[model samples]
Target: MYEATDHPDDDVVAIGPADYPHVRQFVRPTRRALLLASVKERRDGGGEGSLYLLDAAHARRLLAPERPVELIPIPTAYRLDDLTFAVVQGLISADNALGADDRLLDAEEQGLEQHLQRERTVYAREAVPGLSQVGAAWLGSRFCSRHALRWLTKNGAPSALWSRAQIGEEVLPLLLFRQQHQFIDEFTKLAAGGDEQPGVVLCVPEDVVAASPLYQRILFFLALAWLEMRGLVTWVCGEPEYAKSDEFVLVPGEQAVIGTWMRAKDNIWSADVAVRKAQVRDFDLSVRHARAHSVTQGGSSHARLRAAVEYLGLEQTWGTLPRRCAELGAYGTVDMLQSRSRLIALDEVDRALRYVGGLGSA
Candidate 1:
């Protein structure tokens, strides 16, 4: 959508006929997010999750194409969080640099021993409205702040004091007041009441929108997916800018936010992911990775990612893998495993693998 004229008044963006069966994903504020990265036990009884509006700049910088992610050093400020709060530190992301320069690393760590706290507050990071960063916008709107709230804030505005509650503000409730377990279930819950509108069209003030630029729009889609479960569909328009004739906040056939979230949890039928969707994207790669680990170590690897691996043709030669369910007397290419006595058609391999399931325990 354009930044100059588009404005959608409807609850859901009116999708066009040309755009059918399309889905879109939501984006997160690149600079920060209220992540439930750690859990702290409450002295009272139940444990409370520690929410961090993780500053992703260092992490993003490490992954920048210009430098090798492994070589880059995480700022002392980030490392300090791990030592002090006893929270996750060193590498927030898997792609982050593991080792800092030995020469200054000790000094940096020593100096930060006392000062490496939430050196920067949640207030320091300008977040997009409607996302978990919504905490800041919601809180700040009720009071006067030191920095100018972007009519969306990407131009570099400072925010207020940080608080963990802000990050858990929205997500905690969605997950039934517990740390996340089933992401798809959490999002889909919004539709449970059956009041889900086809989609939600956000009418955000430009300042409330994220001011940061995302190189990977899929990140936005990942976050947007969470928003989609609220309705059968999801659309967004930032006003004036997206209110154009040819453009929409997003339109029909236009990728709807609802399908985007589904894509994250469910495998696709066609299997060609979006270019931005082109790469793997998730709100929390760690959580998904953990689930993957559980699936694998728990003796379910054959059922988990192997199908996607096969669909992508990453491990085997598609037509060459031999399959003999010999007991059933069917012998053919892996794609034709079900062909009783007939030859398999290479062109139809995708269709054959479409509904494929677990390869069974190793």
Candidate 2:
């Protein structure tokens, strides 16, 4: 009842609802696989395809390992489940199913999904991919918690980084303006911009925030990205002992509040929408770049975009980000991502990130 057509520049493996449970089992451990699954019902039902980043080796290891599941293969990439397989494109190596091209710089040889792209250098990849919230916090902490603590105890992010607001105004992708064409350079512009764009204040649990500078940086960017919004994020098990070590003011928000998730309920909802909104921006950027990358080039940009989405943990926002990117113009937004479901104070929704963890981790 459903078709698994690959996105023009992306390497997708589409499945059905019956495959959900099977896929879900791999969600936590594998957050790096780009999967599309749905259940067509007797009524008007639709399927949702989320892109997950995969640890090619890890993903391959996690495969059924039975060998030769009966499925057709694609020319670009191969698909293998409990059934057959196919090769859709070039270089669908047997060892790394996700394909080994990490750190995709010139997507020119890869492919194109569009004519032009607002080029930008991503100084670094997503903060950390393929991990649970608590897991992310823990990883973040060991990654120079002392420095992160210094930032907090010192009263905030290095005034240099925090005071200089970056990102965007409508709380969107002002970060991708083609002129600058590099993340840090453009971010430098965002920071130097006179007025702060409206951004939601994200609150991660103190322990996790202190534990991870990358985690703190993510939240820091969130605060600097806000303009007209007054939102709050709550870390469920925040430890006040680390209060002095929690200097979020470094990110440039209006005010800082240290209440529990209970007091920040509305703020939590508002913040989730804010981040979901930004994810939309990132999604649009990826798709456009993918089109610009095209099939002639190897269609890698599309694949990379899908990976980036998973890396940033925006899987659920998949459907909205792509569609909104298309039908809506620069100013258009989505109604669905604005869910009222009491999301976590941090980006802690129980969904899979679908990307490999520790690609660049030391």
Candidate 3:
């Protein structure tokens, strides 16, 4: 059983596995009323004692009814189950429930584990000079296909390196040092060194590398190359694509690869490029920044607190007072606090306001 942590200033609702199903049902645009009802009930004093209300009008606008669901293409179909989508959907649900706040370190870590496991398993099939041949074969059968092999051969051999390198030597170490995980640290170092790039910078956490699903990464990497070959991203790689045409929504990871290809001397377009370019876009750039910021911060404190007000109402929300307020007080990490106060814009709960404002203020 997961206990709801104290996070009064947050903007999202933290539900355990039991509350997930209830939350999931309201995951669509048409069901805004259902969510509104839930929030209304909370604001009017119902259910859990600990809660807060948000400005529903603002919440609706921030969520935007017309925004289509973002699709994150995992490397393998095995990873594309309801659970995976559920997690993504949960993260996107609402500012009160799944706002931009909250620590995604858990999700990022889970994704990393899945990535490493698949990477090791895939390379398990081939007859490595001194490795587990049977395991390698089983992994190959489970994840990789002949098509993947051909792409590895044709492209700059991303997969081939996995086959040849010893786990600890090159493969395992690199995975351990997730480039994304170290991104912020690296960013600080770069910034300190005064090396900021003017181009569209897609910053990912060093902890959460998009390489969990090798195929997904390959597809995106290759797609970027193809776009670059087509001269869409431009050689300098600073041009934004969303302004060009409404039809051409650049999916995540597409621009970077295209930028790379535009910079490449040989310009060998990988077949995986064809498979992945369709999923590329500019939204990912924002996601990358948001995600990194979220990881550093525990979650959106303002979103959480607002949710508390919406769900608990003024009187009932008071029950959440001590714990939630304290949790917000203890919020560790510079990023988590930033997400709460800076990103989500939550004002501290004034004790005088809580007492004097009475039930009306909540």
Candidate 4:
């Protein structure tokens, strides 16, 4: 085990195997020292986990061997929260860099409901597309909770989940997008080509038990998500069939505003309301009237059309789509329109209108 003290020169102490007989036999001396030090730090910190910076070699030694490992450095920041947020942002940015159409898929705009409905029919047939015989049996077993399936359908990429092997007694949740899968495959190929790849290792408190089935699953899912965000690893699965159409209407201007609004911590509701009013004024009276009528009559199509127009107007007016969409809770609509815009060849305005109309029909 590891011990720590206030001494600046001797902050960490490593205990040998004599003190802890059950310690894993294969752990090298240097890793043993690091592990002991980490344990001491955790103990001193009252069991709360601490993050450690592991080198690529150390990371490969410690992390699961089933996948290639690479270490990405966490930026030095004053606050832990800021550090965490930075990692999340980095993940999002990396995913976004894959290009708009190849980014992580959002369930709300991707016909997750329809996918689940289809899964129900497939479940009845005993022939789910992606599951191995062992995985199918495991899925058929009682341990797979309805609540877990419900959560996956509503919040995650269910196609990834359906496509993976689920063999063991304990099944971990898989949440990933199609582009992410491609990203991982490419990384794996590069690693296989003998490229010196770095990887990330998550350091946690020694006292923390990750052995419980539920806890392990949760931990696994979270770790996988974090890594996926960093473009490090992907959940093993077959290629997911996208249920949504490929056609997307591209907004010409800066799209950073959407991300900015998403990351904003301050209340911008009143400001958003004012901006939205200004946005509506850019539309013709007929469009404005239609929006008003839709608001009162619960006609979502007209409202969506107005939102699409407003989004385009916001794009034209330096970047206000974020605040407007956040205020209206129309992220799904905007995402749908943007996604459809990327798929087919149409002028901006015509594409936006057709997308809004198509969304209404869908």
Best candidate according to TM-score: 2
What are the per-residue Cα lDDT tens digits for candidate 1 across 166-204?
Answer: 111122212121112232233233324332222323222
The better candidate by lDDT, 2 or 4, is 4
TM-score of each: 0.19, 0.20, 0.19, 0.19
Badly placed stretches (over 4 Å) of model 4 are 1-13, 24-125, 128-179, 183-362
Using lDDT as the measure, name the better of candidate 1 and candidate 4.
4
lDDT of 2 by residue, 111-146 (tens): 222211212111111422433222222222222122
TM-score, prediction 1 = 0.19
lDDT of each: 0.22, 0.25, 0.25, 0.25
| Candidate 4 per-residue C-alpha lDDT over 241-351 given as tens digits, one digit per residue, 9 for 90 to 100 | 211111110111210001011101231100111123333233222222322332112233333333323322222421432232222222122211122212212122222
Candidate 2 C-alpha RMSD relative to the actual structure: 21.8
Worst 10 residues of 4 by lDDT: 254-263
- Model 3 per-residue lDDT tens digits across residues 1-362: 12233322443443334543443444433332312111212323566433222222323343454752222111111122222222122212322221222243223223333433321222211223322222222222212222222222122212000011111111211111122113212322222322221111222222223223422222222222222222222111112331121111122333211111111122211112222433433434433433343322212333323332322222343454334323332331111211211112212212211221232233
Q: Per model, how many backbone clashes are there?
A: 38, 66, 50, 18
